[model samples]
Target: MTTFDRREEGFENKFAHDEEMKFKAEARRNKLLGLWVAEKLGSSGEAASDYAKTVVATDVDGGEAGVIRKVIADLAAKDVAITEAQIRVRMDELMPQAIAQVNAGT
Candidate 1:
């Protein structure tokens, strides 16, 4: 007689994947926010990295959407050329692979 092993994926695994996707979306948003802020601040190199961190860190206390809104608002307040339209366009271009990476946990 031959025996095979079988297993059932649990609800937790499904939920975990959902959370992972959410996180990945957030990371991509953070990256875009960083670039936006860097451009707005006329910062490059370490300063840009620092600004990105500051913006992303805000999400650590609040959440991903909050950080995104802050970055957009801050740039707008400073009269940067970045518009909500551009942000949405960039996000549309970036989201698919980001979602894949998130699902893969990379």
Candidate 2:
């Protein structure tokens, strides 16, 4: 392949890798968010883990918004009070930790 073609291929590969990392980070963030919400709802052990998994699954189609909606509805059902802004802020805060965890292969 020509140098230009090789460079293009490299760029494509980098883009794919970056996208994968972003997905992993977001999924991790969702899991963390779910666990936090679960704690607020008084879930522990296996129940908390299952709840976190559901949050991750929600992201498959709904992305962040769906997860937020699900958590908000759940918290409200349990009489826990939290605002959308607070959930968004927590998502932002968890992102870095999620990214670090993803990079570390944990």
Candidate 3:
């Protein structure tokens, strides 16, 4: 392959890797968010873990908005008071941690 061809291939590979990392990071963030919310709702141990998994699944299927809606609804049902702005702030805070976790795994 020519130099240009190799460069293009490298760019494509990098793009794919970045996208994968972003997805993993988002999933991790969701899981972290879930655990935090679960604690607020008084769930512990295995129950908390299962709740986190559900949040991750929701995020995978419906993106950030889905995660937010699910968390908001669940918390509201349990009489836990939290605002979307707070959730969003927490999400932002966890993003870097999630990306770091994903990078470490890779």
Candidate maximizing TM-score = 2
Q: What are the clash counts of all predictions, listed in order?
A: 0, 0, 0
- lDDT of candidate 3? 0.94
Best by lDDT: 2
Error of 2 at 77 (Å): 0.0
lDDT of 2 by residue, 16-35 (tens): 99999999999999999999
Q: Write the per-residue lDDT of candidate 1 for residues 35-97, one digit (tens) a residue.
A: 657877688888888887887678788775676687788787777767667766766776776
- lDDT tens digits by residue: candidate 3, 1-106: 9999999999999999999888888989999999999999999999999999999999879888999999999999999999999999999999999898998994
- Residue 21's lDDT in candidate 3: 87
TM-score of 3: 0.96
Number of backbone clashes in candidate 1: 0
Question: Which residue pairs show backbone clashes in model 2?
Answer: none
Worst 10 residues of 2 by lDDT: 59-68
Candidate 2 segments exceeding 4 Å error? none
Candidate 3: where is the Cα deviation over 4 Å? Answer: none
lDDT of each: 0.71, 0.97, 0.94
Candidate number with the higher lDDT (1 or 2): 2
Task: Flag the better candidate by TM-score, 1 or 3.
Answer: 3
